[model samples]
Target: MEGMALNQLFGNAYFGRKVLVTGHTGFKGSWLCLWLTSLGAHVTGLALAPNTEPAHWSLLGLDEVHDLRVDLRDGQAMRQALQEVQPELVFHLAAQPLVRRSYRESLLTFDTNVLGLVHLLEAIRETPSVHAVVNATTDKVYAEQVIKNGYPEDHPLGGHDPYSTSKACAELVSDCYRKSFFFDGGPRTATARAGNVIGGGDWSEDRLVPDLVRAASTGSILQLRNPAAIRPWQHVLEPLSGYLRLGQALLAGEPVEGAWNFGPASDATLPVHALVSQIQAQWPGLRSEYLPGPHPHEAGVLQLNCAKAARELAWRPVWSAEDTIRHTIDWYRAYYASSRLLSSEDLQDYVAAAHNAGLEWAA
Candidate 1:
């Protein structure tokens, strides 16, 4: 199943009405913003400058959005920006999203991940149209002393590292706002936890895919942080679809509530070598030799029981692991083939269709 047409997505009687996307310039955020536009939603984006040079936000040409570059940590600035957007749906994704980076800069990660979420929640209280929000958290939000078959939402919230810890804190903040404030009169906020997402245009360092792709491109060996470690690897679109569908259900004031996981089913859990081999198979000339390296602390065998999401949100990853790699590699190959950066249109259409496909399968 591919994505529904733009009209089918937004034309659902209860369309966007008004929407705002925070951190619209990051990898996941950029994809979310593009989907909103494709579905005919009026979107406003607020985030600090794009984190990467060939930033995903700029690469997606979000200049078409009512784009505002502002620091999320700046409470006043964030509040003012949200007041103007007056969104009916706000997606909070602005944060320091890397675990290793958090170790290098723990305070900054906490400020951006924790405080930034607070700013958005407060902003939504003032904005009338903001009826629903989907706050993005990571699978790392759970207290992972060990890897159960799959960690459920009820698992205690804990973090082994700063990034994971901060995301858990963010979830707590969202839960507080949703229960304490939204109970009577406030935006109905739902938190989303997703697994390791790999896809096109993700050039972040310390990530397995990015590092693997970068090394393969240069004919250099990839140094994996923890090769034997396992993760719930799914295409980026899978979890994103869960986010959009969750937001839609929330806006409709459905019985949907609380946190959910959007990730591949158990079969989708593949190791670093499997992912690397799949990616290299698609793009020849990719050579990888594992060198011993230690990365900032990260979970060893993190898996999420996405059964909750599948049961509630009706979401499941549509693409096979091979498909995820093929699509991801294809994007990089196409960009190099054309000798031009991927246009916002190209990226949006591809990922949107992927999301629609997941939605159809879930249905």
Candidate 2:
């Protein structure tokens, strides 16, 4: 929290404080836990176990993450977990986050993403000690809102698919909670809308970055349903850092509320082919080819304007696509290097090195 203002960073370290992370066992959740540990935060995770093969969280040895495995849909269990933790800072990332899979299970998607968030908010309302609640929402929360060039904070809340609509619905719930409950006498509440996240350890299906890594690892051709689709591509650490920074702000009791977009700067937005090409160049030895395949309906061109984050929070992305792809690929290739074994400590060190190597999301 060195770069953060004194108004923020009031509770930077979790030395004796309680920090609860829902979805701590997923790819992004694992990274959040890693960052929180580095910050010395007393963290507890509540979410379903990793469902993907070659498990990302287990791979990082987060099985000992002081984490409890429970579906977010279980209101009683979720509430009990909240009561037990009594966390001061809550990062709610627990939900059905996949779009393609959501097509297969729309009910679960709606139930988990929308209703699950409601449960967390309800628990926060009942439980004391909840100083700040950073609800994780997707950029898709905007209703059919690509907004031509960049989407600002004022963009309409919307989603095209069940997963996106569910996220939009979650945002709607967050708005309701913020206005109705977490207002004058309620806890400081804010929502984070992030782009299509990519990082080292993710192996989930439907996501292009993870799919490419997995295919490369197994010596297979990569398939892309929407090769021309564009996204506000940023490394996993970028927005995670922003979340921490924002949590710091909220805990300090600063007058910051409502939705904020954590994404790369304008130049960081790239199309699927450009992104894949960057990764391919970084991993020359990996066998890969692009073959068309069926995929869920996704935005053709999506972009975000992080001006609100930059103007108010002074947070911005430090890494460009070239460097992000290089570092991301390096983490995987080096981890699986035949000459040496990568330990948990090695992975942590690598993540730190990546963060420190360049301003990558540091402003």
Looking at model 1, the pairs that clash are 1-357, 2-356, 2-357, 3-356, 3-357, 143-158
What global local distance difference test value does model 2 have? Answer: 0.76
Ten-residue segment with the worst summed lDDT in candidate 2?
Answer: 1-10
**Clash count per candidate:** 6, 7
Show model 1 residue runs off by greater than 4 Å: 1-4, 10-16, 145-148, 340-363
**Candidate 2, residues 43-151: lDDT per residue as tens digits?**
8999887888766677666544687987778888878888888899999888888888899999999999988888888888888889899998888777665476688
Each model's TM-score, in the order given?
A: 0.91, 0.89
Q: State which candidate has the highest TM-score.
A: 1
RMSD of each: 2.7, 3.8
